[model samples]
Target: MASASRDEFHLIVPNESQSAEVKLGSDVTIPCHLSPEISAVDMEIRWFKETDCACLYKKKEVIEGRSYQGRTGLSTEELNKGNVSLNLREFKESDMGVYLCQVISEDRTEEIIIEVEERKDSDGQPVNQSSKIQGRQVHLILHESNRTWGENQRMKMEESALMTEFEVNYVKVLHQTIFKVFKNQGKKLEQTELQLKESKTDLERVLQQLETITEKFGLLENKKDLDMKEPQMQQIEKQLLQITKYTEEKQNQLEEKDTQLENMSKQISEKEKLLESTIKEMETSKQQLEALRQEQMRQQELLEKKEQLRISELNEKSKYLEETKSLLEEREGKIKSLEKEKDRLNEELQDKDKRLKDINAKLIQTVREVEKKQNQLQGKHTQLENMHKMLSEKMRRPENKELEASQPDEQETKSKLEK
Candidate 1:
């Protein structure tokens, strides 16, 4: 039973009322097509009259029961397209029972019950089932003749609207299997209300018919009191009772449909509120995305500016080192030349020591001046070396990676300058 209910969710069948009225000995096709149709050629289809199996079809061949051997059959081609409309050639009294259509697809089984009734009327014609119990989400039978009423145009509009509702539902299911009711809930609520109004009208008409039938029953009772035919009177009473029961059931079903519509309206309101909430959340997410983009742009600009400034500082430091290095070399060369001249003068003055004592003091003064010049040159070279070392250390800092890459070349240049 649990499996059957689950299968109904997957397998949509057009079930009106459980019972179908047909003329005695008439060929009746009970429509049982699967909605959102799929191929059912491999499924095991069986029609059982209570406990006795009427017909059964496996994969290849169809086996008929002794009770309805020639009478029961299913279309092989229709089975391939998920349609298993059972054909009862001669619907007899024995065939009028609660027959179940048990279909085995893969592993799960689904069964739907429908009754085949023989209508006993004056003309033996089948009574119209729609006029009696059309409120049940009874999809018109597959390829059934279109029933035209006195209000042809109005009836067509109602049918078209109802069919549109069904199609819309099918489409929604196709699009989204979950949260499906949230979509077009408003539109569907309106359609349900329209159907509800129509059902009310139908209920009123059935009420009037019931009242007229009650009057007829009273008349029949009066005739019996006056010595009317027993058999005829009893038959009429039976028909009237059946009609009254059917009408009462129909009225109840119509009322149920009204309740269903009201429930739908309430659901639509809830869904509408939910939709509004979701839209607000979407707007919030959009705003957050925009803020993140702006932050990324701002950080990128800051990085670029910092990079440009570092490049400028690296160029200036490199140029300053080059200039300082040349100046150190030039001063060292001049000091060395002055020292060589003073040393030669000192040697000459010593050779003429006895004769030029007065000139010796002037030579001593020149030697002192040359010594001072050499000492100043040595100090400048030491200071320049210290500055160069400090500059190289600063270049090796992590943030100056690009500048540090050229540190080897700068070191080689310093070595050459020292040489």
Candidate 2:
């Protein structure tokens, strides 16, 4: 599987060593050039350490990770030309490691090693030397100022002059280097400060927006409170059910009473035409039956009116229920709309959080760079002081040697006079 995967991927890095050296407290680029150069615009380029512990880019925009946040980026201008170099700021010993740059679009990957070493003094030596004498390997003796000694002195003088000239040139180069670094640091610091201020303002604005969203949510909650409660609707439905049951019972009773009255009318018609002997008895019975009929008629009228009143009341309650249902439907729609709005606000809030994180990372990286530069400046200052002290000691040595040489000549002349 590994072999097959390797065959599908091709990237280019320096063949020999692929190692770039950088001094501590400085910035450096770890190059990962593309083979068969082509425009890499919009390509997903990722720079990572130790198999992707830190991510430097997702595409054109840099992706800040815990380790490389604010400290790593690409040159936006060069990206179009296929330059995928990872630029790391404030190089330190901790940063000396292998980094990989993978081009996801092209399915290619490359690695570069960075070596971070300490900065040397102006003389290209360690800066902890206490005195110039510690650097000397041998001592010299003085003699008379004769022709041979003078020739030797002249030769030494010429060598000293050459050494002085070289030291001066070295110091000049060092001065230029320090000056350029300082200038770059100043520009970076100013840029960082400006970005920090802008980010602070943006964070404040986002907080305000979040507060507004919270307030709107509170208003929606209050509206929900004012709407009809579900428990109340249930209670109304139960009352309607009881009324329908009672009305059905009353309708059944009225239907049974109508059937009974029809049967009795048939009996009365048949009996009225019976024999003359039974006519008198039937008259008495008819009179009593007529009175009962009058009473039943009155009761029927009252029941009919009561039934009509109940029907009307039922209809009115049903109408009210329908209206309440419509209102509930409308409220449901409104609640749905509010929910959608809330979701949209949540998405916006998430986006703002991501922006804030990116800004914070940049700020942190900038502060680190500033501190590194300040330390570099301090080191340079110490180096200059050491160089100045060494130069003064050198000047004093030559004068003291000349006095010793003159004293030797006087001693030889006094010995000759005694002889």
Candidate 3:
């Protein structure tokens, strides 16, 4: 059965409701809770990356492991308070994956996943070079990269070739189409003008006929002076009266036709106005279409520029990668050489250490000998002092006896001489 320590703690991460997506370089906090009261203060905290399933932090220190050595950071203060959130600085696209925070307690172990995302630059550009969009403002900077500039130049040449071909084809087709349409419109306008002129001529002829009838009526009225018999005169007068009536009726009919002609003329004028307006509208539409085409051409040019920039950037990156690989290989070789030198130095150090130990032992032995010699010298000095004292005492005693004898002798001689 699993130990209770393995089931006492739980790890929690932010859900979708809490955050939609977390961007790179942004601080993130993960929450963990211990159930049944955590008592094992010695429990170890570990953070593992899911991409490689490698430990990033362990035992309150960053692991000297492969890729996470310099890239991972964590807050010790937060960890003490059961906050084992890890902060990755300068977040990379590779960091955009799941991470696991593991806590090993006496009774339980818990883990949680954290997702990292690529950060965007101030201009809303992705940090990953592959995901960056080419901007007009960045063109000059991108062109500075030799590879990108070269690719851009090549692409420009290719696009110029293609555009030239397309322009030739498009212009030829457009010219033909426009010429045909203009010719047809011109023919239609000419036909309408001819019809209008014919209508006007017919109207003029009708007016002339009405005028002639009026002249005839005037002649009949004037002829009233030349009379014959009453019946004959009455018949001529009736005929003249009929002729006048017919001329009046004809005049009314001509007036109606003139009105009709005027209406037709007005309609034609209105149609001409409409046609002019339509032609203006068509001109406007053509202008707009031309503008749109020009804009599209500009956009294509921009796209080509972007592609060139991308190709150049890729080449530069490849070169940089190559250089980095070479540097890394050199560093690896240096590290191996240093390792060997370190081993050699360690051996030399061990030999020096042994020599030093021997030297220290000899020094200690010499010190003991000097101490013994000092003690012997102290004992000999004490003995010599005692012997000299004895000798002094003996010499003083003999001298005193000799002086007393001399004095006694001198005194006896003086006594004898006095007697």
C-alpha lDDT of all candidate models, in order: 0.60, 0.55, 0.55
Pairs that collide in candidate 2 are none
Query: TM-score-based ranking, best first?
Result: 1, 3, 2
C-alpha TM-scores of all predictions:
0.29, 0.25, 0.27
Q: Please provide, for model 2 over 321-377, each residue's C-alpha lDDT reduced to its tens digit, 9 standing for 90 to 100.
A: 999999999999999999999999899989888988898898889888888978976
Residue-pair clashes per prediction, in order, are 0, 0, 5
Q: Give the Cα error of residue 100 in candidate 2, in Å.
A: 1.8
Q: How big is the positional error of residue 287 in model 1, measured in Å on the Cα after superposition?
A: 1.5
Poorest stretch of ten by lDDT in candidate 2: 137-146
lDDT (10s digit) by residue, model 3, range 1-419: 22344345665542321322333444344334334333323565555454232333433444422345455555665554445556665444454444556577655666555554444578876544543332211111100011122343334333333333343345456556656755665575566556556655655555565457547556456555333234544654665566566656656755665676567567656766775686568558756866776787789889999999999999999999999999999999999999999999999999999999999999999999999988987776675576557555655777877576556655764574455
- Report the error of model 2 at residue 246, Å: 56
Per-residue alpha-carbon lDDT of model 1 for 77-114, expressed as tens digits?
A: 78766788788786544555555676777777765666
Worst 10 residues of 1 by lDDT: 134-143
Best by lDDT: 1
Q: Any idea how many clashes model 3 has?
A: 5
